[model samples]
Target chain A: MKMAIAKQEVRALSGDEAVAYAVKQSDVDVVAAYPITPQTIIVERFSEYVHNGEVDTEFICVESEHSALTACLAASATGVRTFTASGSAGLALMHEILYVTSGCRAPVVMAIVNRALSAPINIHCDHADSMVERDAGWIQIYVENSQETYDSVIQAFRIAEDPDILLPTMVMLDAFVISHTLESVKVLPDDIVRKFVGTRQIPLVKNHEGKLVPFKLDPENPVTMGPLDLYDYYFEHKRQQEDAMQRASQKIKQIHDEYGEITGRRYGNGLINPYRLEDAEIAAICLGSTAGTAKTVVDQLRAKGVKAGLLRLRAYRPFPAQDVTKVLENVKAIAVMDRSHSFGAYGGPVFHEVRHTLYDAATHPQIVNYVYGLGGRDMPQTLIHEIYKELQKILETKRVKKPVRFIGVRE
Target chain B: MTAKQKGWKELPIAGLCWKPSTEYFTGDWRTFKPMLDEEKCTKCLICYIDCPDVAVKWKPEDEKIEFDYNFCKGCGICANVCPSEAIKMVLE
Candidate 1:
C-alpha cells in the first residue's frame, strides 16, 4: 500500500502568522527573540501560542536580538528544536552570533522577514538583511509568499536537523510584501506536521570516559561547547562549516522534495523556480514577492508574442550555481534584479553571483543588473516590464551598454 | 598538537574544550603564594569564600584552610579580603 499523504488545511494567514504556526507545529522546544518591524509579528504570534497553552515551548523574550540568538544557540546546543525571528536591525544585531551558531553546527532555524538596513531608519522590505549575512554559512531559502513561507519553515527544520547538514537555516520572506500581507495558505494538519517534522536527531559524541553519548549539553556526556580557539584550530573549524554548507544544497532539495511529497506542493527543485523560460529569449531573475509580480509580467509579455521569462531565486545561499547555469543556457539576454546594493562592487550581490555562475557556461547570455526597490520602494510591474524591455534591447544589440542601472528612482 | 592540522572530522565537535581544564596547569603563572598564619586566622573563612579560582581549600574538622597551589594563580585577592591578615602573600 502506498503511504497516504497528509491533508493540508487551508487557512488565510499573513506570512508572519504562517511562520509562527509552522514553528508551533514543529514541536519547537525554545523560541527566543527580540521584536523588530515586520518580524515582530512572527515572535508575537508564537508568544500568544505559548501563552494560550497551544504549544509547550519555552518562549524567551530576550532583551536584545544578540541575546535572543544566543539563547536559541544554547537551547539548540542541548539538542532541541529552536527558532527565532528578526528583520533588518535585529539581524544586524545578531551578526556576531550568527556565525557562532552555524560554526557550532547548531541547527537553529530563523525566519528573517527581510527588511532594509538603516541610517535614515526606514522599516520596509528589502533583501539587505539576509543578503549581508550571505557568507555567514547558514542555509538561506527565500520564499515568494505566505504559503511558501509556512511550507519552507517546516522544511527548514528537516534540512537543518539532518545529520549531514546540521547548519542553521534562514527562511526569508519580504517585510511588508509578504510578512504583513494576508493570503490563503494551505497548512499541514497538526499531527501530520508533528509527524513530518519529527523529533530532533542529535548525533552521538564521545564523553570524557570514552563512552558514546548524545551530542548536546547533557550532564552525562559533558562536552564543552563554543570554546575559544585563537589560531590553533579556528581555520579548521571554519573549513568544517564550509564543507557542511556545500553538503546543504543537496540536503535542502531532498528535504524540500520530501515535504512536497507529503503536502503536494514544492518549489522548482527547491532552489530556482523558473517561469516561462523554456523558449524565452529574454529573462529577468529576482527573489521574494517580486517574483510573483515578475511572473505576472512574464505572462503579460508572452501574450504579446514577447519571449519573456522569469527565474525566481528561491535559495540564495549555497547558491544553485550549476542549476542556474543550466536553466539560463538557452536564453539570449538576462536581467538580474537586486533589491539591495553592494556599495562599490561590480553589481548587486545576486547579480554578481548569477554573472559569476554563468561565466564558465558553454553559451554566455548578456546579463545586466538592476538595483531596484531599495528602502521599501515600490517595484511596479511596469518597472519589471521595463527591465525585460532592457533585456530585449541587450538581446538585439548583443551587448550591455549599461551593465548596472537603477530602476524607478530619480538620481 | 594544534587543531589546525586536523581534518574536519578529526576536529572536536563545536571546538569543545574536551580535555579536563586541569591539564592546562595554570598554577605556573603565580608570582606570589599565600602563606597561612594559623595563630592570626580567625576562622572567618573569608579567604575560602573570596577566592575566584577555588584555590583555598577548607578543612572543616580542623576549622582551617589550605591552598591548592597547583591550580592557584596567586592573585592575592584572598590576602586583601582577610580581616585577620591570615593569608599573607609571599614572593615565590
Candidate 2:
C-alpha cells in the first residue's frame, strides 16, 4: 500500500523523539532498552508511550543493553517484532549477544546513537564503537541527519524481517548531528506505515492439545543453524554468513527503494553514498556525521573547480567489499576520513578495510587514511578541506612517506 | 519407510570426579538419579517433557533412548514426567 503523508505541522524534534515516532509507526511489539545518553531519552519517551497505552508494547527497562537484547532475543524467538537502542559503552555491553541475535536469525532492529567510547569521557559522534563491531553479522545503516534516522529505523525492521534476509540490523546516527538536529521529517501516517509493514503471521505448529506452538526447528530443512561447525562444516557456515551478507547489501538497496516509492525518501545502501563522482580524479571517503561536514567541503572544492567527490559509507559491515571496489576503482586519488583508529594498525581501522576491499582490483586509487575527531576534536569544514588539499599534494608528489595521514593531530 | 541414523556414545565418569564416596552432589544432596524399570517398560513420551534440560532423548524410530549424565544436573524432571510409573528418584 502507498503511504499517505499528512500535512502535519513541521515541529522540531530531538533525535530521540524521531526514534520514538519511528518505533510507534513500525508498531513494534516490544521495546526493551536500558538508559544511556544520548540514547536515554529515546527509551524514556518510549516509556511514556507505554504508560499512556499509546503503544501496546512490553516496554522492558533492562539492566543493560546485554539484558535488553537478551530479552529481545527471547521475545523475537517467540515471533514478536522488537526494538532497542544504545550508544558506545551500552553497544559494547551487548557485544556477545549481538552475535547470538543474528546467529539465531532473529529479525530485531535497533537504533544506535553513535557516542564516543568513554575513557576521558566524550559523548559526541565518532565511528569507533560500531566500526570495531563490523563483523558481528548485523547490517549497519548510518544516517546523516535526524530525518534519515527516523526513516531508516522503520526500514530496518522491514529489511531485517524480510524472509529473503532474516538477520538483525542496526540503524546508526551520530550522537549530535542527527541526534540533535531538528528537521522537518514527513513521517508517513501510522496506518500507511502499517500498510507498508504488514502484520506478522508466524507459522503456528499446534501442540497435541488445542493450543498451538512452534514446531521445534527441524533439521529436515537441511539447515543447521548456529551449530558447533567443527572442521567438517566450519567453512560452509562462514560462507553462508558471507553469502547472506552480500545478499543483504542488495536487500538493503531494495528496502530503500521500496521506502523511497512510499515516502519520497531514498538512501543509497551499497556501503557508500557517492556524490559528484561521475568523472572526478579525486574524492574523499567518509562515514558517519563526518559526511555532513565532508559534503560542505565537497561543495567548496567544486566551487573552486577542484575535481572532487564524496563517498559516504552507510552500510559498514560485511564491509561492502565488492561495492567499494566498483566505486573507488576509477578515482585517481582517495583519502579516507576516519574517527577511530586501531592502536598500532597501519592506519585507522576504517582505512584498513577500505584498502582491503580494493586490494584485488585491476587498478587501484591512491588511498590515504586521515584519523580526525578523536576525543571530541572539532573537525570543521576547513580542516576537511585542508586534508583534501594535502591528499592533492600527496597525489602530486607521487611519493609519500606513509599511505595513512592522521589529520588534525596537534603533534 | 526408512530408519533415521541412530548414534550412541558410552560416557564414562572420568575427569568429572563422579566419586561414589561423596554421598551428596557438592554435598547439597539435592541432585538425584532417575532409576529406570526394566520390567514395566512402556515407551511413553512423558519423561522427555518434564526434563528441564530436555536431556531424555526418546527415539521414536528405534524406540530406544539414552541420557548423558554429564549435562544432566539431576533436576528429577524425568521422574515427574514419567507417566508409566517406570521411573523413581535415587538420591546422590
Off by over 4 Å in 2: A1-9, A201-238, A269-271, B1-92
What's the CA RMSD for each of the models?
A: 5.8, 9.9
CA lDDT, every model vs. true structure = 0.89, 0.73
Against the true structure, whose DockQ is highest?
1
Cα-based lDDT at residue A147, candidate 2: 78
Q: Model 1 in CAPRI terms: which quality?
A: acceptable
Candidate 2 residue A383 C-alpha distance from true site, Å? 0.7
Tens-place lDDT digits, model 2, residues A1-411: 775444343546777789988898788888899988788778888888889988879888777889999999768866688999998999999999998877666788898988889787888877687877778888888877777788788888888887656678998888877777777776777787776677654443332232343422333322223434334334444455556677888878877878777777665653568888877778888877788788888888889988888888888864677777887777878888788888888898778888887778887667888888876678988898887787778668765557777777788
Residue A80, model 1: lDDT of 95
Off by over 4 Å in 1: B1-5, B18-92
Q: Give the Å shift of residue B80 in candidate 2.
A: 29
Provide the TM-score for each candidate, comma-separated.
0.85, 0.77
